[model samples]
Target chain A: MAQIIQIDRPVETSKSKNVIRKTMSICPECMKILPADVFERDGKVFMSKVCPTHGEVEELYFGSYEMYTKFSTYWTDGKGALSPNVPIDKCACPTNCGLCSNHLSHTGLGNMIITNRCDLTCWYCFFYVKKGLEGAYVYEPTMEQMTAMIRTLRAQRPVPGNSMQITGGEPTLREDLVDIVKMIKREGINHVQLNTNGINIALNTDLALKLREAGVSNLYLSFDGVTPKTNPKNHWEAPYTIENCRKAHLGVVLVPTVIKSINDHELGDILRFAQTNIDTVRAISYQPVSLTGRMSKKEREKYRITIPDCIERIEEQTNGEVTKDDWFPVPTCSPVTHFIEAFTKKPQYELSIHFACGAGTYVFEDADTKKLVPITKFVDIRGLLEFLEEKTEELESGANRYVIAARFLSKINGFVNKEKQPKGLSLAKLLTSALLKHDYSSVGQFHLNSMFLGMMHFQDKYNQDEERLQRCDIHYVTPDMRIIPFCSFNVIPEWYRDRIQQKYGMPIEEWEKKTGEKLEQRLYRGTLRRNIAKHEMNQMACATQAAHIEPITGT
Target chain B: MKYVYEPVKGLERTCIRNISISSSSDTVRLDEPVDFTVKLSVAGGIRDAFTSDLWEKAWDAWDKTFRMTYNIGIKKVVAGPITKDVIKSQKFVRRATFYWSRSPELNPDYSKKIWVMVVLEGREPVHPKSVDEAKTTLFDVKKTFRVMGSDLGKGKHALKAFGKASWGRHIFGEKGNSQSVSKEITITCK
Candidate 1:
């Protein structure tokens, strides 16, 4: 059975004003009960909870179904995954829709919408950019308006902080793109990143220089796999190859969207590629697919892969260097616990490269001599605490400052008290110089269809900053231009639809309005969700089978 | 005020401005001549920390003859940079004194001072680059009439002595010579 993690908190009425009393989280990974507290800082809401085996549960605000589907398709295509697997949903609130109180409490908003225009047509495009859906999506933002929006945001909040990222179907398509970058620089934004397929960057040196001058901090590059046989053209919707990203001077993040059957065998190759590109590619983010695109239920099932299996594949490929035994259960509040651990066998610099086996990143250390030691076992909460305390002592004496122990302690403590989190700090700080922030590069979720379709659901929520959400600002250079937030095919309110129709001077009422129909008919019929439900039921039925996990107790 | 510089060789009373009254008929309206005196100052930019030693050296320098011959009417002239103008001798006998102002409230970090020079037309030596008569008349006179220690105006130093004078250099590093030129001035006492 899948692990059940639970989180429960007691209420306190002592304070004069309002206070978040308790929060609960159920990890779908390792089943461990965890109590958590919600934190709010600079308008962003965060949760700090740990599953005994999963490590640290540090999560950002929201994720989309569309994104997961594209990732699934890309990973599956590259990995040649053909198994009946389902990647677990990470952001499942018992209550769905926009009314999630947990989501509502978060105020910090950081997002990167690479592009709606892509070079290839994938089977599972989030925005559904395949042949039949040519007119369905329009994701290009005018350079002037985009620059203005960035300026307005930066004027409101400057960095040492987070800023929205530039993405596109591929953002490099616009000719005068460097002007937009210059505008962002004028706004004094601290961090501006690009999410791209890296095709343009690899080919154009001048573009890279202009981007640097315009203050682009990082690049999120889509890298599916190492070999062409493993990542054939039919498997990947886009023409993303490794050679294209090498030309970029900025850091690159390799995102592999894991599909069960396709690229599953290439797990070792993926890790090796990331390790080799440590100088340019700072990190590798493995995003197992979530279902939300043009893929039917049967298709999703064919590519259903979980984060656990992905880690196990890495272990198998690495010859037990990184294994389930090495990974500890990340802390949780529900019956489920997520386990995220890394091998201590690699050198400090190599280990520093960012990889998300999912439970965010957790750092572990030694107990007695106060020397830095590699974490080789899954320690209980008590053992973890003792080890951390000793590590903290070592830090106070200025011994292990070079290692990640002190920062880890602060992160854990700050996560525990979310509201009072530190200023100008990010979950990314725990990462080393070798890792660049991953753009939406994971093939599993960032497939053309997944990106297009997944982003449709987020149209209303994308431009909003952490503190407030409202109708975003847009400028119409054309007198009769229509502003489509998530492209023309997305489910928009009637008024928005009518306005666009009027601008185009098309038959106001005669133009076909087919909203959510393509999605329902093509992808949702036998969706990934149904497939996972079937798999879970099968597992439940085989209760006494060899797959059962024997719960182990600490000494 | 009388203009005099003490730090040069034997020569005194370099430049002076005097106002005189001449009457002819009784009950006749007469215009009185108004005289003006400006004191120039010269000293090392370096400050002398020891009060007694500084005073001894300063007095010795002042006793020396520092004078320039500038053809002008002189009557009851007081040569020195004005520090305090007091009502004396039934006239505004301005006391030649120098003072410094260092208010921490105004400038907390560092204090600064400005050097003021009084130029006498025609009576001063002409600069070599003084192209015109007007320019030469203005350029010739150079002396230190008074040295205002801490933020004082007018009565600071005696600028009548040419020996105590320093030539003004061009910004691009060119130097000018001090010599007499065909320059003359008419002082109409009105």
Candidate 2:
């Protein structure tokens, strides 16, 4: 007989305390729309919803109510997509969402899933071969279908999305991956990024060079933590992958899927690793694991971590190097977009996402102390934003162009504190050049001096908010040429990703017979023995030197 | 009698003298009125680039160009919430304000008509009433505007007020002038 475990429990409930706001969420069991109340308890914000069939479900929404409210102040509604695929009068949100008119933002980063066939079956991954095994189909879109999808994305009006991310079960597994990149570039997408595990890049020496030559601007490398135990997926292979990326001059952004009690403890070490490898690693993006599949409330509570939670962890782990106050919501850059639109009299790329969806801040390395300096340490970011807003409003009100420009040049010095500025960085001059002269070269200089730190928390059915769904700017383009938001596609895979991919996929039996390999046999085991051996040799050399070794002559 | 003319090297060129802003109080009650003064000074001999007749012609051309291109009209007003009849009636006065009040070349008469638009918590632009002015070597204009209690709600608010000098057409490489000074004020609702 199984052993039974019992623990102390308190059942008294008068009235749930600290209700902050009311929103809408979905039932995890029945997937029904339900009224949800957001409240604070134990310093964490949580969403509680009661479904008629599912009973009561609660999930942590934000780690800190104070931080949530502080970031909420930056909220601004976006000028939704032009030429929405669905009419607002016909249907409600989420149900009619191939980017219905109810959506508040256009697609900023469009994702194209080329193949739903990966080489690794990670325990936490949303996409793997198991889905195909269960459904009896292999989801791999044809090149023609991919081209059509890219066309559909570029055809989006008001502002045709200029950036696209090629994603997959593993995009690098495709033999024609370079050709796909070429095709995307041919379609006139300026920024083409690939989301991949670094195993392929590390194993194939010429592959990184080929991708770079094919115009793959950036690689969204999946790197969880520094230690091998914490990141068994790619810890042993990351160094070689990063070195190959450096050799190819391809920029990489470290993407860590942080789960509490698993890899969350290693965030500070991961950040330190990123700083040391800043040349190849452009940014470190933390994604708190979302409970997409079947999960109990207790399991959800144990695993779920929000953006603020990640930020707080980063602060604690980095020993206050990156504090909560240093970060701002992703949508804080909306003013820059607004100003550009007003000045140029054209539609610009707008990031009008919900403030709670993501937060980011840039950290520059101080020349004197060699320590990372948060942008707010030197530049008066809030003051600069206010100034930009004022200037944009003035421009909209028909302010004289020459006079505004001259005044901006003269008063730019007042907004920046020279004494607090980073060593060898003339922030005032950089701001003046970027804002007044519209010279973006200074922005490149700024990036060269700093690294971007950001975190994005995707939602599952347990905590999905309709408001967030309406404001999502990241979308996935399907083989059928429909644009669905990321959370909607992943969270409710049955309705969007699975349904669409099944229509275009082949039967699993046929795929196995034709490919002459079973699904389980196709998983990627690393083949970069030379690079791994070199890395091991370097580590051994360092260890020997640390022990003060001396070479012996012929004895 | 005229002596041999000699050109001086490194002679100082005409430029803007100074721009300054001051508020009546650092803190104000919500839904109450506050006043601000903006002063602009132009260096001497800056207008030497043009004769009086040429300057007048340039000003006229600038005004005509501005009116033709950007003058807010019935169609544009209709695009906003205000109705054409309401605008046509004496019920509303819709005038374009300057970008920056401290531009050296801004017309003094135009600057007098300019007002400071106070934006609080992303609300509608509040046009302040011009109370006083002293135009000399240094041009000064004082204006007042009210902040709504609802805008502040509670606690502290960042009150951003800027003098907008709208000259219609492009001037000084931009459309208008806006003072760069922003003030933060704590508002206590009564």
Name the best candidate (by DockQ).
2
Query: What is the DockQ for all candidates, taken in turn?
Result: 0.00, 0.02
Candidate 2's TM-score on the B chain: 0.32
Please tell me which predicted candidate would have the highest lDDT against the true structure: 2
What DockQ does candidate 1 score? 0.00
- What DockQ results for candidate 2? 0.02
In angstroms, the error of model 2 at A256 is 0.4
Quote the positional error of residue A249 for candidate 1 in Å: 3.2
Off by over 4 Å in 1: A1-109, A112-115, A128-131, A151-161, A233-248, A294-298, A325-357, A360-555, B1-190
Query: What are the per-residue Cα lDDT tens digits for candidate 2 across A1-555?
Result: 222222111122225567654445667766666656677898888877776655777788898987887776566556667777775652233565788765767888999988778887788997755643577567778889989988888888778878999998889878899999999999989888899887888777788899999989889989887665677777656666777888888888989999988889878777777776666678888999888778876787788888988899989988898898999999889777766776776777888788779999998776666567888887778777766766766676677767777777787787777887777678778877766667878977776667899888888898888668878999998876688999889888877887887788877777789888787675766554344466464442212222232221110
